[model samples]
Target: MNRNVILTCAVTGAGDTTGKNPNVPVTPRQIADSCIEAARAGASVAHIHVRDPETGGISHSTDHFREVMERVREADTDIVMNITAGGGGDWTPDSEDPTRGGPGTDIQTPAERHEPVGELLPELCTLDCGSLNFSDMVYINTAEWLREHARLVQQAGVKPELECFDLGHVWFARQLQQEGLIDGDPLYQLCLGIPWGAEADTETMLAMRNKLPDNADWAAFGIGRHQMPMVAQAMLLGGHARVGLEDNLMLKKGVMATNGQLVEKAGGIIENLGGRVMTPAETRERLKLRDPSTGKIVGGEA
Candidate 1:
């Protein structure tokens, strides 16, 4: 184990979980409040994905992101803000046309998907490595599109957390690193146990972790019931962990949970494994993020 493990809390995802858990925050204020609560519970980073307020579905509107960022920034919280740049990639095939997009399709250009990151300029944002059959639909992130997104994120001076769902995606991330598209020590987030992605198990996590660049800063997460188990696994394997209402809503079987409860549980797991939980400031330094105002790391440090 690395001894110092970072815990990230994903407050609310853009998934269709509104009916499953009533506590998932929809509005910006509610989302910011949940992020604050998670930070209080020992999460050094907050992985955020905004949603459509009225419809309670996923949204990629820059305004929605702006609202959430404004609220979180104005608060006194010290959690590192990690906004999602992985949205606007869903593609549902047309039932009638078959070759074209259907009613639920939301495919977009790389620039469109990254507009919020360019505008908000957060310390960190995600870059999904490749497209996959995400459940019944495809998450369309072609290599060209990914390269474009990576270039834009690097140009904007925001760190990209390469989100790898499977082994092949990890390979692609490495390709990007080799091409010099992704600078500095890369950051990766291993996403496990989605419908068509990698399974949530020690073997799968280890395989992906082994493929990462030696100098990379990485974290792993598992969905639903596998969430907490992955937390312990990541820490024991010398990696960071992520958890929150976005990934798992149940604290126990048949019991719903809040974001704070999830963060607290993950923190407990890290502490029990003889790992020190990182604060937001520590994570920022480790990831090499410059303070927005000074154009240097906060505190003249890092």
Candidate 2:
């Protein structure tokens, strides 16, 4: 098992989850506050996604991103900022015509999807490795799109965390690395327990983790009820952990959880297991992330 672990708290997600839990942050101020709380609660990174404040819908507005970044960056506490570059891929077949995209469709060109990450130049941004049957919709990220997206992220000098939803995604991620599309050692996030994705279980995680490159830095999370259990499982297997409302809405059976609460709970699990929850500084060094303030890539391999 890894003695030192980095915990990431995904504050909000591009889902219809805002109505499911009252604690899900919608406004920029709220999202920033939640991220700060997670950092204070021992999260090394805050994985962020913005939503339309009034409608609680997923948004790709750079204005929303700007506000959230300004607040989080100017905050007193230190937390590695990770923005979603995986937006605008949600696709559903139109009811009237199956060939056409439906009302929920939010597809963006690779250039459009990379706009926020390109402008903000965050320490980290998501690089979804492949598409998946995300619930009833297909989150489309073609190989061509991913390769193009990787080039853009590399140009910005930002780290791209390969978000693998299944075994094939891991394969594609490795291919990206082999092609030198992703700079440095590839960082990975094994997204588990989403409907039609990899199962949130030990065997499945191990299978995915086994495919990672030798120098890979990886973290894993389970959605909904398996959130906490997967934390222990990942830690026991020497991998990092991720938690927050993006993947889970409840603290217990019927209790809604705040972002800080989830981070706190995950932190407790790590400490109780005699493991160290890494600080943001350590996380940067471990992940070889460039400092936004100093604009230099710290020298290390996680």
Candidate 3:
């Protein structure tokens, strides 16, 4: 295997993992600290998502995002921060009226979904493409909504990581690219192993990866037990890999893992495969990322 890879640490997700594992960070400070530790453990990027401090459920509050960003910035770590713009899409049909949302729904407009990303303007933010039955609940991301969010992300001068959960989602992402909704070399993230979406197997991964645009920069991740295997699979297939407590909480069966541990484990896997992990600076250069302030690729790489 080639010895050059980028490892992203999904520090904390917006999932309901807090109750399942007490080690999952709930507060902004805790999330920021976990990201810093992961960065120190060979992660080039930290994919972040904040939760309600009180309820521990997913939240898209600008205040919470600001807190997390400020804390991470204050630490002066070189890790590239990638905040999620994927929240507020959950919906449960009304038990009485199937056409309407039920009490558990948290649907919002595209503008509402972009609020946090607009506020933070992180180096990278996710843009989930297409919609699917996310397990029992529906993840509603209509084409109209995605176009609006993509425009906002472009205007903010942030790189939008196109997140595709299935083959159709990848096709929709390509459509967005064709429409010029996204800017620069499109960055895609193939999300696998979620229920009712793509499975986390080599065949599924390859099929999705082969469909990406020729000039695209992309990464792939698998949830649960498929996480580590996908790490090596992605590396061998000429793409980056992501791992963390958010995707897989266990280091082994019945054993919980911290964000740092997950990153370190992925790093070891990459190294063992003869791939050298890329640092954040190297990743920024390879991806041709512009300094948000200067609006040009920094460090003279471009």
Model 3 Cα lDDT, one tens digit per residue, 178-209: 99998778899999999999999999989998
Q: What RMSD does model 1 have?
A: 1.5
Q: For candidate 2, lDDT tens digit of each residue in 106-180? A: 999999999999999899999999999998999999999999999999998899999999999999999999999
Judged by lDDT relative to the true structure, which candidate is superior, 2 or 3?
2
Error of 3 at 106 (Å): 0.9
TM-score, ranked from best to worst: 2, 1, 3
Cα lDDT, all candidates: 0.90, 0.93, 0.88
Residue 181 local lDDT, model 2: 95
Tell me the spans in candidate 1 whose CA falls farther than 4 Å from its real position.
Answer: 298-302
> Model 1, 1-302: lDDT tens per residue?
87798889999998888899998999888899998999888899988999888988888989988998888888887788899999989999899998999977887798998999999999899999988888899999989999999999989888899999999999999999999999789999999999899999999999999999999999999999999999999988889999998899899999899999999998988888888889988887788886655667553453
TM-score of each prediction? 0.97, 0.98, 0.96
Q: What TM-score does candidate 3 get on C-alpha atoms?
A: 0.96
Query: What TM-score does structure 1 among the candidates reach?
Result: 0.97
RMSD to native for every prediction? 1.5, 1.5, 1.7
